[model samples]
Target: MVNRVEITEAAAAVVARLEAQHGPLMFHQSGGCCDGSAPMCYPAGDFRVGPQDVPLGEIAGCRFYIGAAQFDYWRHTQLIIDVVPGRGSGFSLEAPEGVRFLTRSRVFTDDEVTELAARGEPERAG
Candidate 1:
């Protein structure tokens, strides 16, 4: 059975406002140098949930779709979803769109944690 990702108050506000016009919220993980991970809330039907090759628990009324490639990349991720007031109204639908960055997993590889610490970066909590 699918379970929803924990949502933050800030995230809930964003989701509620968007749901009024669009459909459910959606979050997906992608590979990249920037952000290391990307959390996007897409209009329902804009993308399919997938073939279940990846692990995607639900969050609020949306689904956090983790791609197979991405899931394998961050096998130790403990991601969480939270609501935050969007930049502003109509912000959610603006062209190029608005994506709320949710929290990340607390667990990390020895190399990942070391890299963050070496860079003097704050570690994320579970």
Candidate 2:
């Protein structure tokens, strides 16, 4: 099945380095505003996944989530997780690594949207 989220090779390498330092991880797409909407990486269970969030998919062996409201806005697109030079949010694990987890997106085509609509939102990760 086509995934709604994916990670670039560079980001995967970063994930590897992070996992070596911190173990299994997770990601939360910022809810915008103060955090500036950067995707934040955290050690698994560090960030709580509640009803307000929806699981998009996994990337670099990590679970990913988007706020329900943000998911409503982005349901038509696919998210591409990447790494860029620079520090990210202070709370994100990658911040100390001198790189940030960036989110790039593309709108889904009609057919892809139809398929996704049929599948519905993925079940939230436990």
Candidate 3:
């Protein structure tokens, strides 16, 4: 099955460092005004996953979610998480690390979309 979300090697290395410092980690992309679609990382269970959140997949051993509305907008694309040099939202755990988690994307190909469709709708968060 084609993964809906993935992380870059640089981002994965950052995730490893964050995991070591903060234990388990999780990510949410809300597409909200405050963060402007930036991917926010948090200690696992710290950021409550709303019922309207869709689980895209795991990235670097962390579960990644997107708001249901955002999912609808990005459903045809693959989310690529990468770490960039800068400070992000104060609420995101990566803020203090002098880097931020960013969500990059690429449109899915016809075959990949077909494969994803065969896999069925993604499960929603509780």
Per-candidate Cα lDDT values, in order, are 0.54, 0.88, 0.92
Candidate 2 regions exceeding 4 Å error are 124-126
The best-first sequence of candidates by TM-score reads: 3, 2, 1
Candidate 1 residue lDDT tens string, 74-101: 5555466653333323222422235455
Question: What is the C-alpha lDDT profile of model 2 across 1-126, one tens digit per residue?
Answer: 778999999999999999999999999985787556889898999999887888988898999999887888887899999999988666998888899988999998888988888987676544
On TM-score, who's better, 1 or 2?
2
**Candidate 3 lDDT for residue 115:** 97
> Tens digits of per-residue lDDT for model 3 on 1-126?
789999999999999999999999999999787566899888999999989999999999999999999999999999999999988765888888899988899999999999999999998997
Model 2 lDDT, full chain set:
0.88
Model 1, stretches more than 4 Å misplaced?
Answer: 1-4, 49-53, 83-99, 108-126
- Against the correct fold, how does model 1 do in TM-score? 0.58
Shift in Å, residue 7, candidate 1: 2.5
TM-scores of all candidate predictions against the true structure: 0.58, 0.93, 0.96
**Which residue pairs in candidate 3 have backbone atoms (N, alpha carbon, C) closer than 3 angstroms, thus clashing?**
none
Best by lDDT: 3
